[model samples]
Target: MVTRPASPSSRARLASARGTPRPDRQMAILLAAEKLFAQHGYHGVSIRQIAEEAQVPLALVGYYYGPKSELFHAIFEHWQGTIQERLALLQQVLAGPPTEAFLRQVVEAFVRPVLVQRASTEGEYYAQLVGRELARQTPETHRVLTEFFDPLAHSFIDAIHAARPGHDRARAAWAYQFALGALLHHITDHRAPTLSRGRNQVCAPEAAALLVDFITAGIAAVMPLPSSLSPSPTASPSPRRRAPSPSTTSRRQA
Candidate 1:
């Protein structure tokens, strides 16, 4: 049987509740989970530890979230509002049609929220948690990536592809991947300032603009695939490996 979508009224109500002061029990569990998951990985964390950190009974953890994977997914589901804002911003930029500045616009759309999150108090834990999980690349993390991250990425990739039709699909894909990689790496690396001798920092307000400029240039640098590699009208014949000369073959066989 088909299921109806959530009504706008119900959605807004839920959003309001989530944004406001939630019950201590649930928020405690989620915060605990985020902390533990950030410190230890998904595999390293356990339901018991989460319960301990939350200061709630172990049963409550199970009651609130059926399984560890579900709980992990819930952490992301809790943050859907931020993701929605990013998508909305991207959609607005896309509506303006392609231009020379399209790549910069797309990069800004992707990078701004990320940098914003990196700078905010609540967002610090979230950025760390997300970066750690992504780096871990465990089976559960893979599930999260597919369920939440890939679809969002695909949207931006499509926008990038549309903006630069001259580039091949492979290059467009690479550009998107590179841009995301840079963003995530910057967020995850807390030692950036120390490592750079205090010359560079990743979480500054202007960081997003700098990243946008760099990423847009990187995306633009993808050279088109060579003409020889392009598909031929008639099926291109595969090059045959030359058979060894009879004398050389006989000598080798001997």
Candidate 2:
């Protein structure tokens, strides 16, 4: 028997099997840039490094994203979808009564996506990148981070006020900040198991739920009603004792 030449379809299949399908070049560059930018501050990473990490030509990074700033912006845009999910859930929550339970749901909607992303390999890098951006807090990166997070934060703050009509709005804002601090802490340093010496641990699924609980309770704790808003106790008149006092005086004199 003689060996036969492979058909076109078989050849394509062989090529595909021999190598993994590559992601879109632009997207790969952004992803690689994000991981590097997160590991090193934006100022510390170069287009060349991103290209090398992405396994693409140095010129391709510039061709796709133009410059380092634009490449960084692309990472922000990539996460826009996640922000949209948060906003949609927030709108849905706002559509209903702003009860405590609903507020917790809103908190879950805001934070769960971020924590869930950490559970995946790619997402882990993204989360680290976000945390790093926060730490660096240069004027440009600060503006970029704020542009994405501030609007979402305001919506939640409004919902929190609606949930407890009498709660202090200023305190509620502080609570929002505190909640963000907690999330950033988790993202940058997830060493709970080490801290507890392995007695306590938080898995990804549990992390979201626990965070919702912690933040919701924290908000509730901080946002107490002002005295003006609190219900006043009813005042009662003192009982009349004049007659009894006079009788007792007379009896003592006799």
- Candidate-wise lDDT, in order: 0.69, 0.66
On a 0 to 100 scale, what is the lDDT of residue 173 in model 2? 67
lDDT of 1 by residue, 52-159 (tens): 998876765665676898788888887777777777787778666434456677788888877776677667778889877776657777766766677677677766
69 Cα displacement, candidate 2 (Å) = 0.8
Q: The CA-based lDDT of model 2 is what? A: 0.66
Candidate 2: list runs displaced more than 4 Å.
1-23, 97-100, 199-203, 225-254
RMSD for all candidates, in order, please. 14.5, 19.1
Looking at model 1, the pairs that clash are: none
Candidate 2 TM-score over all chains jointly: 0.74
- Per-residue lDDT tens digits for candidate 2, residues 25-143, read 66778889989988887899988899899887776566556668877877877778877887787776656542336657768877877776667667777777777775565766766
TM-score of each: 0.75, 0.74
